[model samples]
Target: MKWTHSRLFLAIVALIGIVTFANLLQSFYRPYLPTITSLSTTNRSDVHENISHEDSASRISSGQGVKNKNLDICENPYLQPGYVWYSNTTEETNTTWVPFYPSLLDESYSSTTLETTGEPVDPYTSDGDPYFPTEQPPQELLDVSPHPWMQDIVRHYKLYNSSLALKQGGSSSRSREVLEREELENRLHWLRNRRILIVSDSVDRYQSEYICNRLGLELINSNKGRQTASWCHIPMWNLTLMNWHIASVSPTKPAWWWIQSMQIVNVEERWTEYYLPTLNDTIGMNGKSPDLILFHTGLWDHTYFIRAPEAIGGKASWARSLNWRELRFYMQRVRMVITMLREQFGDDVPIMCRSVTLKKSLPSNVSILNLDRAARFVCNELDIEIMEFGEIIRGYFEFYKDMVHIDRGPLSVLWANMVFWYLFRTQGGVEVRGDLIEMPSNGTEIVNVAKEWNTCHGDFMNAKRY
Candidate 1:
C-alpha cells in the first residue's frame, strides 16, 4: 500500500521481461497454428463437445464404442502432435476382412475381383498373370519335350505304381489304372464342381483326349466316325469336359457354297443341326453352365481359305487366297458367337478365345481382332470377364507340331498343364495340380486304342521321365 519509486521500477522491469517471453513463445509456435480463423472463447467449449459427440456416434455405429474415461478427445488439434486426431478414431470390429492393399480404396485404382470372392488371396492369386508366347518365336533351338514338372509327374505315377503292383502280385496295367483314377479324382477335386467346354478343331480335340485319358475315359474311335461332339463324366469329381468341333463360326459363303467349294468345307452348315444342338445339350450337364468355355478356330479358317502349305487335314483345296471380304465375314461370325454366348449365359460364365496356334502368330489379325471384339462386346458390355487363353500359350508354339497341334507326347501334357495351372490360380481358388499322361509318339493324332492302352501301352514301362 506504501508506494516507493524503487519498488515501482522493479515491478515495471519484471512486467517487460514477462511480455518478451510471451512473444517469443508465440513466434516459436506460429508455424504449427491452423490457418482457420480462431474461434471465440465462448464457443470453443461447445465445438469441442460437438466433435466428441460426433466421434462417439461414429464409434457406436462402427460397433467399437466402449466408454473409456481415460481416452481424451481431440480438443486442441493445432497444439497436438501429427495425427493425434486419428488416434481418436476408433477401430471398428464389424468391417469385413480384406487383403491389405495400400491403395485399395483409391478411386483411380482397380483390380480383378477374382481373389476377393470370399476366398483367401494366396501366392498364385497375388502373383503376376500367367506367361504365354504372344509373338513369333525366334529360331532358337528350344527343347521341345515334356516340361520337367510333367516328367516328374510321369515318373511319380508310372514307376511308383509299377513297383507297387509287383509287390501286390498285381499286373502293371492294374497299377496304371489305379493311379490314373486317382489322378482323375485329384483333378476333379481341384475343379471343385466346375466344368469346361473346349470348342475347337481336331488339334484341340487332342487336348480333350489327353484330359480324358488322364481321367481314364475311353477315347472314341475316329475311323468309325469323327465325333463332332462328345463328353465324358467323372461322377465323383462332378466334372465334364466336352469337346465340340467347329471349323469356323462364320462361313465365308452360303451353306451350299461351302458344300460345293472344298472337300473339307467350313462346318457352318452344321450350325443349327450339329453345332448348336450339341452345345445346348452338352453344356449345363451338371445343372450349371460351364464355368469356362475355350473357343479356338483361326488355324482352320486360315488354312482352309489361304491355301497355307500345312492345310489342316491335308492340303488346302482353295485355288486363290481369301479376300478381305471373306476374312471380315469370318470375324463377324466369330463375334456373333461371343454375342450368342453372352446372351445365353447371362455373364455367369467366362469365355476365352484362344489365339491361332502358329509360329509368329501374334499378328494373326483374325484371331487378335476377333478376341478384341469379344472383350469389347461380351466382356466389357456384359460386365463379365472374357479372357484371352492365347496370352498364356502363345509362347510355346515351337512345342506344337505343324505350328497348329500341340505335339502329343510330353508337349501336349505341358500345354494341358499350363491351362490347368491358369484355371487353378485364377478361377478354381484351389491348390494347383495337373492330370497329365505320357502319350505315344504318334501323339494325340490317332484315336487311342483302349485295349492296347490297357495292355503294354507304348513303352510306358520302358520310358523314363529323366
Candidate 2:
C-alpha cells in the first residue's frame, strides 16, 4: 500500500510541474505577438479608396493607428517631381509622415478676372463693400482679439538675443547657434507630421535655406529642381519644406517686349500652372494640407514695373502690359491670388503675406513701397494675415541690400524667427488663453477682424460650392 501511494504522489507532482512550465513559456512569447492592429491584411487599394471620400479635416486625422514599423521613414512618399536627396540616414523612425489621400481640385475650382483697376470699391457703393472688405487694417487686426494670443506668444519669446534688440536687456547672451538649435528642436516637436510651403523669391529662398540649415536638414536637390519648385525634407521631424518661386510676373517669350507687344495674355496663368500643381501636391482630400504657407511676390513686381532688362541682371520679364500707371491692376492680381489660395486651402489654413522689403538701388522706390502698402491693404480684404516683417524692417535701409533684400545677420534671423513664431503660435495643441489666463476664452471672437469668413467650413460639399 505504501509503494502504491508513493507512485501516485509522484504522478501528481509531475502534472503540477507540466502546468508551471507551460505558463512560463507562454509569458516569454506573448510580447512577440502583435500588439498593434496590422494594416497588412487590409488591401492597399481600399486604403486609397477610403481616403478619396473623406474630407480634408477628416483625412488629416486618419493617421490614428499604431505607428507602422515596416514603413520606411527615410523614404519621402510625397516627394514632387524636382526634390532630390544628397544624403541618407539609417536610424529607425519613431514619427511618421502619415500617408494621406491627395485632394484633387474638382469642377469647383474656378477662375475669375481680377479687376484691372486696383482701386478699392467705393465703401458707400451699392455693393456696400467696406474699404477693407474682409478684415480690419493690419495693426487693428493685431489688437482687440481673443486675448491677444499672438502678442502673448511673442512676449513669451526672449528674442532679445537678436543683435537688433540689444537695448531690450533681457535677451540671452547664448551663442546664436545654440539658441537656433534649441528653437529648431521645439519647432520640430510641434511640427511633427506637418508641412510648410514657402512661396517667395530668391531672398525668401535664402530664408527657407536658413530654416533647413538650422534644422540640420540637407537640401537634397540643392539648385537642381524645377525653377518654381524646390523641396527640403527633415526625416526626423517628418517635415517637408518647399519653395515655389512665383515672382510678381510670369516669364513669356519675346522677353521684355512681351508686355508691350501683347504676345501673351492671362499672364497669371504662368503662376497658376506652377503654383497650382505645387500647391495641389501639398494637399490631400482625405489627408492633410500644409499647416502653413508664407508668400511674397511684390519685389519681383517692383523689378517688373521698372522694365529692367535681364541682361542687366534683372528678374525675368513676365508682366503683360503692367506699368506704374497700372499699379492698381497689379494690386488686383495680388488680391486674386490670395483669394484663390484661401478658396482652395479653406480659411483654416493660415496664409501670411510677408511685408514687402524694398532695395534702394531699385528705380521709383517710393512707388514700390506704396505698392507694398497697397498689397497689405488688399490682404485685409482677402482675410489673410500679415507677418509684419515689412513694418519691422521699414526705415532700416542699412540692414538691406540692393534696397529689397535683408542682410544675412540679425534681420534674417529675426524674419525666420517671426515665421517660426507665427506658425507655432497658431498651431494646434498649444496652450490657449483659457489654459493660461482666467478669462472666459470661448472661441467666438475669432472673427473680430474678418466678419464675413466667420462661417464654419464644416461641410466639404458646401466649401466646394464656394
Candidate 3:
C-alpha cells in the first residue's frame, strides 16, 4: 500500500511539471506574437491609407470637385505637358505695369523742374527690375491721379497697424457699415464655436501664434516644439509630431520602416533630400484633416541648392541659371507638392501660400524677382491664394532680425496683419474700416494700355522711361 501511494505521488508531480512548462511557453511567445501581428497590420494600413488619402486629397485640393466647377475661376494651365513653355512666353509678352502707391514710394524733393522729351515712358522699364522704380517722378506725376486698383492696394497697404485692423475687421465689413454691423453680429455667434487649423513651417509659427492670440484662439504648432506658455495670451495647439534633426544628407536607402518599427525617438532632420519624404510622413500621420492648411517650406531648399537630374524629367536649363536655380527648384518642388495636396484636399481646403520674407538689405544676389515670379506662377496656376508678405517685408526691412527671421517688435505686427488678411479674405469677411480706398475708373485700362504700348516699342520705349 505504501509503494502504491509513493508511485501516485510521483505521477502527480510529473503532471504538475508538464502544466508549468506549457504555461511558460505561452507567456514567453504570446506577447511577442501579438506585437509582431499588430505591427504588420499597422504598416499595411499606413501604406494603403497613404496612397488612398494622397490620391483623394490631391483631387479635392486642386478644385476638381463637381461643386467647385462653378466656383473655381482660376485656370490651371500648368497641368498640360507643354503648358509652362506657352505660359512663360505668353506672360512675358502680356506683362501688366501696375503702379506702386505713391505713399509707399520714396519721395525726393528737388528744386529743378523735370521735363520729358520723347514720350510718356513706361515708369516700370528703365528700373531694371519690373516691380521697383528707378527714378522718382515729379510730385505732380506722382499725384497725377490714383488708379482705381492702386488706391485699393495703397489703403490695404496702410492698415499695417498690427492687431487693431484684424480685431476690428474680424466682425465688420470694410465696404459698407450696414453689412459690417450684420456681419459683426453673425461673427459673434460663429466665434462661440469654431475650430481652425493653421499649418506652417517654423517661420510661419510666429505669425500663426500672433494671429491666434488676437482672435483669442489657441495657436497650435503642427511641428514638434514648445513655445513658452506666457509668450501667448491665448492657448495655442501644436500638431508637430516630430522635431527635426537635420543631417547634411538623407539616408541613401529607406530607413523610415526601421525607425518607426523600433519606435525610435529623434528630432526631425530638415535635410534637403528628406524634405519631400518628411512631408509625406507628416501628411500620413495627420490622422484627421484640419480646416485650414497654411504651408511654407522653401527656406531649407533655398539654402541647400539641391537639384534633381534632367534624366528625371527636370528642367536642364535650370542647371545654367544657378543664380536663380535654387529658387526655381524650390518653387518646382513646392508646385509638385502643392499640386499633390490640392488633388488630395480639394478646393474647400483654402490653401494660402505666404511668400518668403526677404532678408534686411536685400542680398545683391538674391532678389524677390524669382520668388515673386514663382509665387505669381503658382498662385495663378493653382488658383490658390497668396499673402504678399514679400512686398511688405521689402518695404519694411526694419522688422527683420536677420536675413530671414523677423524681429519680435514690428515683425510680430506684420505677421499678425498678414494672418488677419488671409482669414478675412477666406471667411468672406471684408477689410478694416479705414482699409478700403477707391480706385480710378480707368486705372486698369491705363496700366494695360501702357504695357501693350511698351511691348510694341520694345527697348526703344524702355530707354525713354529712363
Leading candidate by lDDT: 2
Quick one: best TM-score, which candidate?
2
Ten contiguous residues with the weakest lDDT in model 1 = 78-87
Per residue, candidate 2 scores C-alpha lDDT tens digits across 114-147 of 2233454765564533343332222221121112
lDDT score for residue 390 of model 1: 44
State every prediction's TM-score relative to the real structure. 0.44, 0.47, 0.39
Error of 1 at 100 (Å): 24
Sort by TM-score, top down from the best:
2, 1, 3
Higher-TM-score candidate among 2 and 3?
Answer: 2
Q: Note the residue pairs that clash in candidate 1.
A: 132-392, 133-394, 133-395, 136-360
Q: Name the runs in model 1 displaced over 4 angstroms.
A: 1-188, 214-217, 221-227, 232-238, 252-269, 276-281, 284-286, 304-327, 359-398, 425-466
Report the C-alpha displacement of residue 276, candidate 3, in angstroms: 15
